[model samples]
Target: MAHTIREKNKLLARVKRIKGQLDAVERALEAEAECEKVMHLLVSARAAMTGLTAEVVEDHVRTHLVDTELFPDALREDGVEELLAVIRTYMK
Candidate 1:
C-alpha cells in the first residue's frame, strides 16, 4: 500500500527488530535454556509481531478507509467493520 511505502523505513525497522527477537528465541532454544527463559523470549517475539500488526492495521484503516475519498461512505463503513471483525478474531 502507498501508506506502507510512505512509512517504509519505519516499518522495516520494526521488522528488523522483530527478526532480532525471533533470532533470540532461536538462540535460546539452541542453547537449551531454561523453559521459563525460552517462554519469555517466545512471548517477546509474539508481542513484537502483534505490535507490528496493529501499527499496519491502524495505518490501513486511516489511509484507505478513513482518509481516502475514493470509497463511498457505505463502503468505508463496511471496510471498517470487516477490519474490526478480523482484529477481534485475532485478539482472541
Candidate 2:
C-alpha cells in the first residue's frame, strides 16, 4: 500500500531499534551478566516489540474499518476519498 511507501523509513527505524535491543540481549547473555540485568534487557525488548505490534494492529483496524458517527459525511456523502486516504496511510 502507499502507506508503506510513505512509512517505510519510519518502520525500518523501529525494526532497527528492535534489532539493536536484541543484540544487546545477546551480548548480555554471552557475557554472562546477572539474571536481573538480563531480565531487564529482555523485558525492555519485549515492550518495544509489543509497542510496534500495537501500532500496526491499530493501523490495520483503522484501514479496514470506519465509524460513521465519526465521519457522518463520509458514510452518507462523497467521502470515499477520505476513507481511501486513511487506507493509503494504514495499509503500509
Per residue, candidate 1 scores C-alpha lDDT tens digits across 1-92 of 45689989998999999889889988988999998998998888888888788777866766665435565453566667787778857753
Model 1, residue pairs in steric clash: none
TM-score of each: 0.70, 0.66
All predictions: root-mean-square deviation over Cα? Answer: 3.8, 8.5
- Tens digit of per-residue lDDT, candidate 2, span 24-59: 999999999998998999888888887776566655
Best by lDDT: 1
TM-score of 2: 0.66
Segments of candidate 1 deviating more than 4 angstroms: 66-92
Q: How accurate is candidate 1 locally (lDDT)?
A: 0.78
Q: Which stretches of candidate 2 lie over 4 Å from their true place?
A: 65-92
Given candidate 1, what's the lDDT at residue 18? Answer: 89
